[model samples]
Target: MREDFLLLNPGPVPLAREVRTAMSEPMVSHRSAEFESVYERAQNSLDYIFERSSLDGTKTTSGGTSLVFNGTATMAMEAAVANLAGEGDEVVTVVNGKFGRRFKRIADRYANVTPVEFDWGHPVEPEAVAEAVSDDTKVVTMVHNETSTGLLNPVAEVGEIAEEHDAYFVVDGVTSLGGDEFLVDEWNVDVAVTDAQKCLAAPPGTSAMYATPRAQEAFDGEKAPFYEDLDWHLRKAESHQTPFTSAVPLFRGLAVAVENIEEEGMQERISRHRSQSRAFRAAFMAMGLSMFPEKNDESEYSNTLTAISLPAGVRENPDAFFDAVTDRSVSISGGQAHLGGEIFRVSNMGNLSSEQILRGVRAIGEAFHEAGEDVDLEAGMAAAREQLR
Candidate 1:
């Protein structure tokens, strides 16, 4: 692998130098005061991210607690459902992509799941969600950004439906929280989850969630998994710690990562992500590639990752195209599940510079050429350059 290989996959994005350096600091005991201070620093920064993640300064949330756990966002996804819903309770899950389906599967384990399904790569309809949720529903779960198809779901619209029905609203903001606009309280989100590896640009193995007072009032400790009881997690958070032995190094990395976000400022970071994503889409279009997802009035393209359908030539031999990309010292992702070989996804998350985004466009264009496709490399580069400007 090249020393300067670039990562354009959706999660586990390239980390900042400071974040990488912080993770290598001498190992500290989880119970030590030093570690507690580290946890406090991370928690405070995360609070800033959660509250001030809006693209504009018009939206902000307060009076909620942020909890960090020793697992990825999937664990938090389960905790959100387990602690709020039980057997016989109905959970309305809006499924448009892989992550949304995962929420339904998790909800199925603890509650009766009612899925408002849509074809992958298609936007979710708020009217469908409104029809699915009712007063009898105990929970409503949605994925804010469906990374698989590069589509952003309508969280605020669905959140209003959940709020109207008086159900606990749990949103998987795994890919959107730090990179895009997420108005938690404004959207009536009771529990919102995100990962360190994704938008936070930290190392993998840690995740965090924000729980509103309403979620706290509805929490049931016994129903939650032994290792994922939010009630116990909340108690431990008061002292700036976790209920179990935490990943100290990852927390250190996360602290530095969120502090980096703070220094960059949420508005500037969000704008960068948006601009990069636009550049990616523009480049792909100029190369004659079509986007994978279809947008609607309520939902639109993801501002962190872009998914493009493969050209006929490349789709016939996707591995060769991907190999060409890797040969260029760049790594992008193929589609997941049934969409495999049909589409490729690239991420604009993390602290990537404009130069890297342009390089990614050039790499993809060159790879397509290598795969015997007729993509206009110069046109793609020019389109991307214009957007980056």
Candidate 2:
């Protein structure tokens, strides 16, 4: 297949040349000494990203051991819960969007679930979480960034609430860990999951999770489903290995991606993502497109993706809205679940530059016009330029 369109979807984002080259190298043996070096390097990167100095499993709250699963972020999310929340234990889930709802679904299968749901496009309030947790609540699961609605939840505030209640906090940080600012230890995140495809700027084959020592207490001799078990993963990860045969190529790609992230510096990478998101938001607002989320302030906005409603005429024909934009060689995303066809999501993650964002805004403007919506392309571009500057 020939690649042509500019991929602006959240995960499986456009990869860096170095990461691609690393993946393109010859196949490697997962058991070889060479692979062990690669595995350690990746673990070191994960450590830095999780804000831990080591993974020696010494500290109760900050023992930063990360497990890389040979599956998608969904698998890691399940592991984080399955390993902690067992039968008879109550689990609290914050459902503000699709991904948050997924935590409730997964938790339902393993334990008693108490869902604290919010409006689809609104952020989860800390007070609501405080009200949900109790003595029987074993886990409190939340999404750091609700990718479905482009709403950033109050992770820190909720983390503190969980701590006060002595409930384990499991966070789905897939879209925020690398692109946005996150501190597993500082935020009291007991278990957090992230993917290689989203902000990590790599292909999707493996996902990683950070588990603190206190979280390890959830193990009750009974384990989760075979492949998703964190006990088996931690046992193998001690030797810089996985329980099953791993995808060596994706590991190589991820290692390089982590190196590139280190070179760019975490703060610089976060600032870049923020700038890109600001530019995209400014352009959309200038073109008279309101965000799907009704935000009173910027605190609830996601820096990785923006969910914007289509213009009046364009909303009448959702397919035409998508087709017109794809016809211009730009690949953004439509909303998911109940939000389907109502809003479009634009991701500013991975290796995207200012020029690509400008082009994307232009393509969207063209698509709006093509769909018979009267849009001010010049005004949108000007607003974007101001933010980018």
Candidate 3:
């Protein structure tokens, strides 16, 4: 990382050098025995990481499985929808943020998609989800942490509904897994999807989705469009392989990454993310910053990323603030598309230390000053430190 570039973005935040080095090894053939062994390790590692039945999800290590879909978090998503839902099958998708909306668009190509959209910063109601699950509801999807608006949806409740109705519960844990509290088996999720770039502390190309037995059962007989074919992937996945090749380096890198989490413990990592996130929020509140999500309790507050309403005038010219922070070597981002110019999303995914918190607050306070808003950097930083401590 350059002294001028500090990655505070929600995705692709910052990766440890060890994982990156593993990804930088010599390339090998997908069909090679060495590759199969490498593939098996990754599948096993991901199964544990995603909490896959203590022995589930795709155990495949072949082609690009390690990388989160060709450098974007979207591919893993496409894979999940295509592999799980079939043509004309109605899927109820929650659209509370950009990510959820993106899922809707992706589903439109393969299934009969029914979108349950809510206010930009609003949380999806469990009751609403229950009501939305019509008889034809074969699949239900939502982003646990809607990175677009930084809202967390109710996965547990949604999962329960899926259990009651026998529908597949597909959760986009892209911004939550590895950094937030998620239970694959206990939650009863059919297809739990996530990208390594977000909170897994891996590079952008690696993402994963854990399939419960029910999800696997649903995959059979339902032939999806080619490329997103779940059947083909599963056949290969069953043998700890893939239908196509994967980025070998991320496969290796992700294994090390998952090993790190295993050694440190998943709950411990969740606590770290929660603590840092709580501190970040408290500090923002003390500085008179307003949280967009409104409620942080059971609503959609995420520990990995939090969205805030940009202060007045700053939204008019976000660059002044963005540039000021960039000058300080901290990188934050605005929302996506329609919501972009109004909200600012701050992430503590990777490489965010308690020391970095001080620097981030200082940069934000200084930016407000540059934008002609009086601010107390010390007070914000102090509150943040206290929250962490």
Candidate 4:
């Protein structure tokens, strides 16, 4: 890889120098006082992010405990489900993208799942979600930002429906928590999970979740997997520790990453992400590319990433186009699952600057040209510049 190689994938974003340096610090025993201090720092910084993660300055959470997992967000997702619901319980999972479906699959292992399904790339309807949830529903799960389709779901609206039924609301805020607005208390989210990668801009391996008192009261350790029992995790968290061994280096990196978020301020970070996303969208539109997802009144495009439909010329030979991009020392992702080769995705997550985003736009435009497409590179650049300004 080139020294100047750029990573524009949605998760595992390019880390800042300070975060990388923190991970390289001398290893310490997971149970040692030194490690516990690291854990405490990470947890405290995380609490700051969780409590202040609002897009419009209208919502913030308080009094919730943030817990870390040695595994990724998927583990946290499973823990949220397993600890709350069990065999005869009904879990209402709102599915509009891959992550939402994953939540349903996890819920299936422990409870009877009621899936409120929608077409991929389409907005999830809160009314439909309300129809699915009832007083008997033990829990309701939703993905805040569907990374697969670049659509931000109506989490607050869906959360309201779950609240009406008095169901435990679990949200996978994997891509939205740190980059966009997430109102845990105002949205009535009982538990919310996020990965160290994604919006946190740290290395992979570790994840975190926040649990409210209501959710804590409902936790059943005996019903959960031994390693995922929230009751045990919470008990251990009082000492700033996990139930088992922890990822020391990843936790160190996460501590610094959240510290970076604190220094930059949540409002400014969210503004940067939103601005960069708009720039990418404007650039793609100017080059005659359309976004892959459609939005309703309750939904909007994701602020962390942009997914564009592949032009006929590029879609016919997607590999060559992506190869061209790779040759430029920049990396972006293609659509996953059935949408593969149909769309391409780029992320503005983490601490990306305007220049890097502009370069990514130019690379995509050049790739289109290589694929025999008549995209206006200058026009795309101009549009991106306008948005950045």
| Per-residue error (Å), model 1, residue 304 | 0.2
Which of the numbered candidates is closest to the native, going by highest lDDT?
Answer: 1
lDDT of each: 0.92, 0.85, 0.73, 0.92
Cα error, candidate 1, residue 101 (Å): 0.5
- lDDT of candidate 2 at residue 77, scale 0 to 100: 91
TM-score of 4: 0.98
Candidate 4 clashing pairs, residues 3+ apart or interchain: none
Instruction: Give the distance in Å from residue 178's predicted Cα in candidate 1 to where it truly belongs.
Output: 0.7
Off by over 4 Å in 1: 294-299
218-322 in candidate 2: lDDT tens per residue?
A: 654255888777777888899999888989999988988877776776777788889999999999899988998767798689999999987667767999989
Q: Compute each candidate's TM-score over C-alphas.
A: 0.98, 0.95, 0.90, 0.98
Deviating ranges (above 4 Å) for candidate 4: 56-59, 296-299
Candidate 1 residue 146 Cα shift, in angstroms, is 0.1
What is candidate 3's local distance difference test score? 0.73
Best-to-worst order by TM-score is 1, 4, 2, 3
Tens-digit lDDT track of model 4 for 55-156: 765549788899999999999999999999999999999999899999999999999999999988888889899899999999999999999999998888
lDDT of 1 by residue, 66-140 (tens): 998899999999999999999999999999999999999999999999999999977889999999999999999
